[model samples]
Target: MSAHPTRTDTLVIGGGVIGTSIACHLAEAGVGTVLLERGTIGSGSSAATAGVVRTYFPGSPLTGSLAVRSLAAYHSFADRTGTPLGLERVGFLVLFTEERQVEDFRREHAAQRAARVKVELVTAAEAARLNPLLDERSVLAAAWSPEAYACDPAAIVRGYAAAAQEAGAVLLTDTPVTGIDPDGRVRTPTGDILAESVVCAAGPWSTAVAALGDVHLPVSADPIELLLTDPPDTPPATLPMTLHADSGLRIRAWRDRVLVGMGRPGPDESRQAWLGRLSRLLGTVYPALDGIRVHRGWSGALEASPDGGALIGRHPSRPFFYAAGFSGQGLCQAPAAGEIVRDLLAGKQPWTDPAGLSADRFPAVAPSLR
Candidate 1:
C-alpha cells in the first residue's frame, strides 16, 4: 500500500459513532491518534438511527450497566458538546398485540428490574392514557421504564469527533482504509499509517476490516430503514419508545414523525420496509397519526451480531482491537465502549464490561467466510 501513509500512537478506523467516541477518549487520555474514514464522519448508520438510549436490555449485567453509564456520559456530552443530544426523558413502552406476549413482557420486565433497570408493566388503560391513540383492545399490556431515553445520534458523534480533534486527534475523511497488519500498521486508499494500536470501529464493515488480522467477527451487514414526517413538531403525548410487544416492530415518535423499526426484517427487505409497516402501525396503534404524510425516508446498514451484543475488547491475536456488532444499540453504548477501548489501548484496567464483548465470547465465524 505505499509504505506507511502516516504514523501515530493509535489508528482508529471508521470515524462513525463508535470510532469517533473511541478517538475522543483515547485523545483525552493523551494517546496520539489518527482516525481515518472512507466517507464523512458520522455519515453512516449513526446518522440514520432513531437514537433510543434504553437501559432495559434483557441480559448481561455488564451491558446494562454500560448502557446506564453511557447515558450519563451523554448527558455530560450534550452539555458541553452543544449537539442538543435531544436527551428526552421519555420512558419506553413494550406494546403487546398478543395476550401471551403480555406475560412475556412482564417476565422481561421482571428480568430488567432484577438487573436493576427501572422498569415495570402497565395495563392497556394506563398505556392508552400514556398515548391516547393506542388501541387498548390490540395492545394487551406494556413494560414501562421512565429512566430510558433517546438522543440525536449525529450530533453526539459529531460532538465526540469535535472533542477528539480538539484534544489533538487527527481525522481524515474520504480516506478509504484498505488493510492493516499486527502491531498497528494501517493501509488506506490514500496511504498507510503506523501506530501503537488499531481500533477497528468500522461498524458494518467491521468483519471486512478484522479479516486483515485473520480474525472473523460474527457480524453481518444488516439494513434498517426509518421515516420522518413534516414538522410543527409537537411533543408526542408522552409516548415512550415502543418495541413490538408482539412482532418485530419497534416504534417511537421522534420530532414530528413516528420512527419505526423492526428487530429483524425479511432477507430481501428494502427501504420500503419502513414506510410499508409504518403506515399500517399508524393506522392500528394511533389512528391519529394515520394521515401524517411521510416527509423523508432513509436507510443504513449496521454491523449486527447473532446474540445482539457488541464486541468491545482488545484483539486476542493482534495489536488490532474492536468496538463492533452494536446490532442497533451503539448510540448509547458508544460512550462507555469508547472509554473501555481507551483503557484497553492504554493497557490500563477496563472500567466497564468486557466479558460479553470479548472475541472469546464469540468464536470467529470461519476464516473462509470472513
Candidate 2:
C-alpha cells in the first residue's frame, strides 16, 4: 500500500513554543498547517526555560514592544482556549548592587512605564520587604514590576500545540524533517511533504534547518546552566523572581523548591563546578538559600541573534520563512511571533514592522550544519 499523502499550506519544522504558537495561529485562521518535531513538543530548550514572563527590556525597544504585545495574548490564552498557561503572578524584581547601576535601573523603569508596564523604583529596604530573602546590604536599588510573572514553559507549549491540533493542524511528534528544498519540499523518514511555505522554528537546530533550504540564519547556540534545589518546608511564594544584576545570578520559586541560574563569564564549566560556584554566590547574596541542597541541575541550549532580537520574516532568497534567534527570550515573545508569521503568510500588514528582524540584515555566510 502507498504511504498516505502529507501536504500542508504551511509546514512548520519545529514543535517548540514558537513553532507551536505559529501553528495554532495559522490553523485557527483556516490555513492547513502541519508541525513536525524531532522529539516531543517542548522537549528541547523550551523545557529547560526559566519561564520568567515580563515586559521589561530596558534598552531594547523592539524586543520590549514585542514582549508587551505578546503578554496580551498570554493573559487571554486560558480564557480563549480553556488551557491554563501555568502563570504564577509572583512578580519580578531586578536588584542593582552598584550605586552607578541605580541610574540604569531608573532608566529601565521609565522605559517600562512608557511601555505601560506597572513598575516602579523601590528602595533596598522596600525590596527586602517585598522578598525577605533579599540581601538588603548587597542591593542598592531595585525595579519592582508587579505585572511580571513566572510560568511553566512546557505548559505553554502544550497549550499552543493543543490549540493548534484543535484547529485542524497536524502535529507529528518524533517526526523529524531530514531536509528541505527552496521549493518547499520537505524530506522526512516516512514520506515527503510538499508545502506552499515552510517555517524554520527549530530552536538550537535552526541554523541546521536553514541550511537545508540553502539559507543562512545568523544564530548561535547559547548554553545556559540552571540549578534546582530540593523542595523546602514552605514554598517561597512571597519571593519574586529576583535577578542579581551585579553577579549575573537569578533565583526564583520552582514547584516547592527554588531554581537558580548563573549567567555569563563561564558557560563552558562542568555542571558540578557551576553548582559549586552558585552555592558560594548564594551564600554571599541570599543567605537564606545558602545551605539548600541542590537536588538536580542541567544545562540547556538557547539561540542568540546578532542584535538580541528574534529573526522573524520571509526568506529573502527562497520560498522559505523563519522565526528563530530569540536570544533566550523565545517563550516571552512566542505569542506575538505566531501572529507576525501568520500576518506575513496572509499578506497582511503586521502590527509591527518585521524589516528590522529580517534574516537578510546580515551577510549570507552559510555555515556547515555537519
Candidate 3:
C-alpha cells in the first residue's frame, strides 16, 4: 500500500456494475474520476445477479423509464464499450394465477402502454408457446415483453471497467475505504484520496460506507437466493425469463443450464430448509421439473429502500453523492443511474426526472456506525 496521497475531481466507491457504469460515464464526460473497490470488480452482488434486463417494473413508472433507457444502452453495449456482453434477447414472461393478480397486471399493462413500452397481455396458450416449460393450464393470464434480455453481469462490469480505463478513469481493486470525511478526503489502506466529490455506489454496503462520512442513508441489506439446474430434456433454443406473480418464482435459461430464483429465505431458516422450500415451490410451479436436481445454490444480498426503488442524488449536507438501494434492480438500471449521477455532478439536468429517486426523500437519522 502506497502512502502517497492522490487527488481526483470525483471519487467513486464500489466496483460493481453500478460503480463501474458511473465511472465510465464520468470519464467519458472528461471528468477526472477515480474508482475504488473493496474487492475484485463485480465479485459482490453484481456477480450473483440473474442479469435479467427488462422494462417491467410494475407500479413504478420512474423505474420503468430507467429500465427502458438502460435497455437501449445494453442493446448497444458492445459498440459503445468495445466488448461483448453475451446478451441474449429471449424476452420476459410473467404469469398470473388468480383473478386479483390478473387485475393487478391489467393496471400495470395500462401503465406500460402509457410509457410506450412494447408489452402485451397474452392468454395462457400464448404464454405456453413462448415458454414451453410453462404449465399454461394453471395460469389465468400473462404479460409478455418482447424486448427483455439476459446477459452476463460480470461481463457488463468488466466492459464498463475497460471503458472507464480507456477514458482515463483510475480503477483500484482490493482497496477498501476505511474512512471518509465530509470535506472530500477518503482514507484507504493503500493511501488517501482527496476529491471534489465522492459517490457511494457500494451496493449492499452503501449504508455502512455512508456512515463512515457521518451520513445516514435509508437502505437495508436484503437476502437473495438462486439455484442452478441442469437443462431439461428437449430444451428450447432459448427460454424466455418467466416469473410467477403469485408465488415469486422466477426462472430463466442461461446457456446450457436453467436458473431458478425464489423469494428471500426466512431469518431463522437453515440452508437446507430454504432449499427444501424452494424445491417444493419449483415443483408446484413447473410440474415437469418436479424431480430435476439442482446443480448449485447460492445466496447474496441487495440494498433495498423502503419504497423498493433506488436512492440517487447528493446528500443534503454532504459534499458527496450516492446511487444505491435498487432493491435487486441495480443490474438492469445501472446505465441510467450512471447517467443520472454524471449529470448531477456536472451541474447539468438529467435526461429523466430524478425527483422520485432523491436521497433526501427519506427522513434523516443519526449516523449509526454500528
Candidate 4:
C-alpha cells in the first residue's frame, strides 16, 4: 500500500449501472465503500442503453432469475431510496415469425411459469390488439409479460449513486484505477486504496480492468447501436416494447418518439449504414413506421461472456470479486447483481442462487482487444 492510502472496506471500480448499484447496496449494508470511475457516471455503455427492462430469457435461468429479482427491486426502488426509478411498465412483447419459434417460446414459457413468472402467450391478433402498430399479417405468435418496464438509464445510475452517498459511500469520478493487485490494493492516479475486497463492475471494460491484477476474465466487447426516430403521427404512450426475435431488432416508446436497438453480430462497417438497414427492418416489422426518418443514432460497447450471460462472483484466488459480462441486459439485472455482490462480501447466502454466474464457469484467459 502507498503512503497515506485511502482505506476502505470495499473498493468498487466503474461508475456504470452495475458498479453504482453495488456501491449502493454495500453502503446500505454499513460497509466503508469507495467507488472510482474513469469518467462521469453512466458516461460509458450505460449512456447509450435503450433502458428497456424486461424479464424474458430463453434457456437462461440465471439471467431470467436475476431479471425477475431486479425488476422487483426496481418496482420498490423509489419507495426504498426516495429516488424515483422512472420505471414505465408498458409491457414487453417477443414475437415469433414461425411455428418452430412459437414452440421454443412455449417451452421457455413453461419454464418461466414453473419459476412463478407471470407471462401470456398470445396469437398474432392478440399481439396486434396490444400494439395496433403491429403488422398482424407478419407475426405468428408472441409472448407478452405485462410486468416489463423501461426507465432512464442515467436516472437509475444517479439514483443508485445518491443512495450510496446517502449511506456514506465515497464516489470519485474522473479517477481512473491504473493498476490493481490480488491483495486488494487499487492504484489510482491520486493514490493507492487499501481495501479488504475489491469489485470490478466496469461494464464492457471489466476484462481490461481485471487484467491490472493479473486476473483474466473471459469477457468480450460488442458494439451496439441505438437510433431514436422522430415522433410518430400519433404517439402511443401505452405501446409495449416490441422485439422482432427473428430479425434481432427491438423497439420501445420513448416519450413522443421511439427508441430502436440493433444487435449486429460482428463489427459495424458504418453506423449510418447499419442504422439505415435496421430502420428498413423496423419498417418490415411495423409497416406503420415505413420511411420514418431517424432523429439521432449512437453506438456503445456491450460486454459478453462465452455463455452469453453475466459473470458475477469472486475471483479464483484473490480478495477480489467481479460482476460484468452482462451483454446488453445490465440494466435489468443490476439490482440483483448488487445484492449478490453484497451477500458474497458479507459471507451470507444470497436469496437467489447464482451458480450459473460464477466466474469459474469460463477458463482464466485474458480478453483480446479486437
The 0-to-1 C-alpha lDDT of every candidate, in the order given, reads 0.75, 0.81, 0.85, 0.84
- The order of the candidates by lDDT, greatest first, is 3, 4, 2, 1
- What TM-score goes with each of the models? 0.87, 0.90, 0.93, 0.93
* Comparison by TM-score, 2 against 4, better one: 4
Q: Which candidate is the best by lDDT?
A: 3
Cα-based lDDT at residue 215, candidate 3 = 75
Which candidate, 1 or 4, has the higher TM-score?
A: 4
Global local distance difference test of model 1: 0.75
In candidate 2, list every pair of residues with a backbone clash: none
Poorest lDDT segment (10 consecutive residues) of candidate 2: 361-370
The residue ranges of model 1 lying beyond 4 angstroms of the native Cα positions read 1-5, 59-62, 79-84, 98-111, 229-236, 263-265, 268-278, 289-296, 364-370
Q: Write the per-residue lDDT of candidate 2 for residues 258-336, one digit (tens) a residue.
A: 8888764475777677768888888778777778787556678979988888999886555577999998889889999
What count of clashes does model 4 give? 0
Worst 10 residues of 1 by lDDT: 361-370
Candidate 3 vs. true structure, TM-score: 0.93
Which regions of candidate 3 are displaced past 4 Å?
Answer: 1-5, 364-370
Q: Candidate 3, residues 1-370: lDDT per residue as tens digits?
A: 1223399999999999999999999999999999999989888888878878888776676788888899889989999998887777888898888888778777777667766577778999999889888778889888888878877888899999999989989999889999998679999987899999999999999999988988778889987878888777766676899988887789988667788987677889887887788788777667777878886667789789888999898865555899999999998899999999999998889997777788656645322321
Tens-place lDDT per residue, model 1, 1-370, is 1123478988888889899999999898888888888889898778778778887764444566778888878878867565667678777777767767766656566555555677677888888876665777767777677777777777888899988888988989888777777656777767778887888898998888888756677789976666665542354655677776555566677655666666445668654784576667666776666666765567889778778888777765557788899887888688889988988887788875466677667545433322
